[model samples]
Every structure is written in structure tokens, then in C-alpha cells.
Target chain A: MRAVVVDDASPVPSFEQVRSQVAAMIRSGELSPGEHLPPVRQLAADLGLAKNTVAKAYAALESEGLVVGDRRRGTLVLAASASPETDRVRRVEMAERAAVRYLAEVGHLGFPAVDAIDVVRRVASAD
Target chain B: MLGDWLSIVVLGGLSSLIFVSGLGPFTDRMLDRWCLRYDVAVDQHGREWLRTQLRRARAWRWCGFAVGTVVSALPMYANVIDRNRAADFATPANRFAPWLLAAAGSVVGELLSRRPPGGRRAAHLATRHWRDYCSSRWVAVVGWSVPVSVAFAVQATQSRDLGWRWSWLGPAVALCGSAAVTVGLRHLVNRPGAPDGLDRLVDDALRADSAHHLVGASVALAGLGTSHAALALDLGWLGLLVGMGQWLAIAAWWYVARQETWNVARVRWSRS
Candidate 1:
């Protein structure tokens, strides 16, 4: 079974860990559109976190348009879009967020902006 | 002086043994062996989670033990105090009430103590239903039989009137109580797996073990209740024999509980 892990030891915040993993799953299409996410309370209880932590994660996912919440049914994965233009728009938005995070991480290692961008191309071709 | 001391020592030792013997098989010695098996908790997270569970289980045993001992003491004292006690005092309720009440106490303790917090963990994407934990064969046999037997007992009990003005109330209470337990078992089975990061086998084993016991407790209660209701109501030969069969089934439960915990381990769950 696929899982979303929240490691207390991780530098990333617990709610961010949940949001990032769930978002990755949705983008990869591992969680299909219309699939229901586990309820906030159940997921929070399972992870032994306060309910608000999971609720915040869910809210973040909802704002990113990866999932939507319903009063009766619970959170469900949403289709990125049917049109190619909207899909590219959502894709670029995600790429912009990733590029910022990547740059911040590499900058800590004393890499200049040009070198960091060069490394992304090198890593992409190597993969 | 030495002879007097020796006699006192022997008598005191005997009394202690007799008291401890009544606590049944789930003793301190056996509990150590059980906890040792869970040294299977390789990581600190798993160990902490299991430690809480073991603590709750042992803690509740004390609660139940105290409840049973106190309840059982009442009838035991009454029997001893009055050697010439009338037949009324020797009734089934009088004879068996202490142990029955003790069992009730233990059960209540288990409910009070069982759920431990689910700590840091990964969530399995799939949701588990109550049906996943048990076997279909079990459902067909014991599942169908529990309600059927309870109903039979309720019907057989009708032949004789309890001393109460509303005799039907006794059986009604039994039915409602059984229903509540059945519902509780459903919720427990359906509840999410342990909060700790456990391997699939350990997780399934724990779940199956709990579900097995809940069913066992219910069947035992129903059988014992039926036996008492029929016999206490003085529902003659046919009803009494039906009651006897239920009694025998409960006796089987004692064997299964002891033997299965050690022997069944993993495969029993694999089949289900």
C-alpha cells in the first residue's frame, strides 16, 4: 500500500510533509481524480497529531486546487483541468514553487544562481 | 516456638496459593512471556506504542481482578457464614454471581483501558472494514449462531416466570446488552490500525486477536446468560438441556482463548 509519512524528526514541518506527499501523489496520478481522501480527524488520529494540523494540510491542498472538500462526503482529488492551457498553467505554477524551494536549498550550499540552474539541467539530463 | 511458626507459615502459604489460584491463567508470569514476544518492536516508535498498550492491558487486569475478588468474596463469605443457609440462598445467582460479576468487571476494565493514542505514523491508503479482520467461515458458523442461540434462550426462558412482576424484562435486558456488545465490536474492528509503525503481520495479528476475543466474550456471555435464565426460571428438562449445550460452548471458549494466543500467531489471519 502507498503511504504518506509524517516524520517528527524531519526538518520539514509535519503539515507540509503531509501536503507535499499528498500533492506529489495527486500530480503523479497515483491518487485518481474523484478518489476520496481519508477524513481529517481519522488521518490526524492515525498520525497522532492535533486535528488542525491535518485540517491545515487539507486546506492547503484545497487552495492548490489538488483537492476539494465537501460537507457530507469529505475531501476528493480534483482533475487539474480538461483544457491543455489550464493544465500548463497549473504545471507552471507548481514548477515555480519547486524552483524557489530548490534555489533556497542550493543557496545554503553556497551555490550561485547560475550554477544552481546549471545543476538542474545536468541532473535532469542525467535522470 | 519453632513448631508454631512452621504451622503458621504453612497455613499462610496455603491460603495465599488458594487466593492466587482463582485469578486464572492471565497471571504475572504469563504476561512477561507475552510482552517478550512484542520485543518484535524494533524501533523506538514501535516500542513506545506497544509499551502503552501492554501497560493498559495489565492495568485493567488489576481492576478486573479486584472487582472479581470483591464480588466473589461476597458469596463466598455468605456461604461460609451460614452453613445452614436455606435453598433460596443456594440459588444459581448466589452460587455463581461472584465469578460472573468478576468476569463482568474484567470486561468493563478492558473497555475502559484498551485504546492507546496512535503516535507518529504512515497511513495505509486503503481503508479497512470490519469484514477484513475475520474469516467468512467464522461468520457462517458462530456469526449466524450467536443471535439464533440468544433468541432460543429468550424463548425457552418464557416457560418459567422470574419472581419480578415484569418477568420479560430480564430477557429483554439480555438482548439489549448483547446488541450493544455486537455494535461495540463492529466499531473496534473497523477502527484504524495501530498508530505505531508495525509490519503488516503484527498489525493484522493484533486486530484479529482483538476481534476474536470480543466475539468470544459475547458468545460466552450469551451462553452463560441463557443457561442461568433457563435454569433459574426452572424451565424443565428440554430447556435445561438447551442451556447445557450453550454452557458447553462457553467451556470451549476457555480452551480456544488460551491455546490460540500462543499457537495461532500469524497464519490464522492469513487465511481470513
Candidate 2:
């Protein structure tokens, strides 16, 4: 169990920090596949987070295939390479959602929907 | 035939509340206005608030929804009314029980109130995520209504002897469907770099605030109507009617209040 900080003062969430730090730990081999992680509720208490915040971080990890939850055994790390596609999909999904939000903002402010779509296209296509 | 016609119209009305609320389009308009006003590409405050509220609302709404279910089901659970006795309103107990449950469910949930004042400044501070939920909650509301309407149909067709048994099915289906759709929508639309999710975090709070006042009013009306209808019918078939009315009133009121908030937020955002 590593120390996880809840940086309410920063715009970045505690979960983002946890995700990055945990990834760093995995990369450095300080944490390894098959290693068990703390339960969400316990970790939240340790980190001074709302339980859901910890759960969100865990969900991100789980979705990335960086971790897998064993019904009886709790959440354990998975070999990062095993779910490379999951990582790609997650990234794509994040990009898509962000794009949608951006498009939505543009459309709502009295821009034409087609124009908003064109803007996104041009921006993405640009260097 | 008369009863069937009545239930269909009533159920249709309930379903309509889910669709014609204009919440989604209205929310989008508001968000656009906010973005234009701020002259910023991203809605930082809106996103922050939405993420926070979605998580908080979801956890709490489930609890409230559960309590509402239990309260609404009390009459049947207590055996104060049964299927066979549903249509016969000649008895005082039969007449009052279902209405009592409907009112209880609607009003009890209302006791947990959150409303925001509608104005430009108040709106400027509103989040895009809340606005998003305001725009899209209809999908959730309408999705859940499918099962509810089906269950109501089943309850509508059952013979008198099977009234009580079938009566449970409508709400049982509705409760489960509502929970599933709500959770699914939350997950599917969860915003990254945001807290909680999309709608539950920010807009739901404002929605709760804006519409909190209507819970009492809806409960009073639905409860009174249901009780009266229950008293008239010996078979308790009218429980469906009362239930439908209560759901419509609350859902519609929630949509309207949230939409207004969303609109104001957009207007303020545009000017600011």
C-alpha cells in the first residue's frame, strides 16, 4: 500500500495522481502483475477520498487491464502487455468523449452542428 | 374495454413525460450559451460541478429510489390491499392504501430537497456536465419507461383474482429497469478528467434543488387521486393509474425545473 494523496488544492484529481504513480510503480517493477491492491473502501480511507473516487481510479485501472478484480481475491495487477488493445481502446474512448464535449460546447453556443464537426476535423487533422 | 382505454391513455401520458420534456435540447442550448459568454473553449466550472454531483447524486438517488420503492410497496406488503380486492373501492382500507403508498413514495423522496435560484450569475457558475445530463437524462427516463409501461400493461390485463400478484410486477419491473438504465447511462457517459460521471455530479444537484419543491405537491395530488380511485374499484386496478400519475408529475416537474436552470446557466454564461 503506497501513500496516495488527495490533492483537493490542485485541479487534477487524486485519482489521476494515483493512476500515474501506480503506473510508474508498475514500470519500475516496484509493483508487479499478480500483486494485490488494497480494496477501494480501505484505500479511500487511507487516501482521504470519497469511496467513489477510489472506485473510479480502480475502474480506470481495471479498464486499462493494468488490474483485474478477482471476486474472491480482490484486485490484482495484470501484465501490462496482456491488454495493450484495452489501453488503445480506452485512449480512443477518452479522445472521443472529449471531442464530443468539445463539439457539444460549440454546437450549444449557436454554431451550426456541421460547422462544429468541421472544426473538430480540421483541428484533429492539423499539426 | 373502458378500463383498458383508460390505462393506455394514462400510461401513454406517463411515457410522454419521458420524451417531450425538451430537457436535452434545452441543456445543449444552455451549455452553448455558457461557452459563448465565457469565451472559453472548455467549461471548467460546469465540468467540475457535474462530475461532483453525478457521483453524489447516483449514490444518494439509489438510496432514495430504494426507500421510495419500499414506501410505495407498503400497502401490498402489509396486505392492506390484495389483487382480488384492488378494484373494489367500497372498502376504506382498500381505497386509501395504494394512494397512501404513492403519496409516501413521492413525498418521502421530496423531503430530501435541493433547489437553486434561477438567475444569470447563478447560471454562469453552472457546469457543462450538469448541462449534459440535463440534455440527456431523457434517454435514461425514456429507457426506463419501456419496462414500466409493459408492466402496467400486464397489470391492466390481469383478471381480478390475479390483481395483487400482477400488481407487484409493474412496479417491480419499473424499479429494476430504472436502476439498471440509470447505472448504465452513468457508466456509458462517464466523463474522464471529471469526477463522478456526467449528469449525476453537477446538474442532478441543481435538478434536485430546482425540483425539490414539487415532491410535496405531486405526492398530495397523486395520493389523493390514487386513494379515491382505489376506493372506487374493488380490484385495485386503479393502483396503476395512481402510480402512473405520480411518476408523470414528478418526472415532468424535475425535467422542467432542471431545464430552466440549464437555460439560465447558458444565458449567464453567454453574457459573462
* Model 1 residue B78 distance off true place after TM-score fit, in angstroms: 3.1
TM-score per candidate, chains pooled: 0.58, 0.25
lDDT of 1 by residue, B1-272 (tens): 35534544554455445445534344444444654443233355655554555455444434444444444344344444554553334333433433344345434533543333533567755544445554333334444444554554456456644454233333433443365346645555444556555665555555554555444544455555544444444445776586675557567445433334422434333333
Candidate 1 — which residues are off by over 4 angstroms?
A7-16, A34-36, A39-41, A52-56, A59-127, B1-66, B79-120, B135-159, B165-197, B230-235, B255-272
DockQ of all models, two decimals each:
0.25, 0.01
Clashing pairs in 1: none
lDDT of 2 by residue, B19-50 (tens): 33312233455545534433334356554453
lDDT of 1 by residue, A23-89 (tens): 9888888888878887776676556677899899999998888887776877888775525765576
Error of 2 at B193 (Å): 5.1
Q: How well does chain B match by TM-score in each candidate? A: 0.59, 0.30
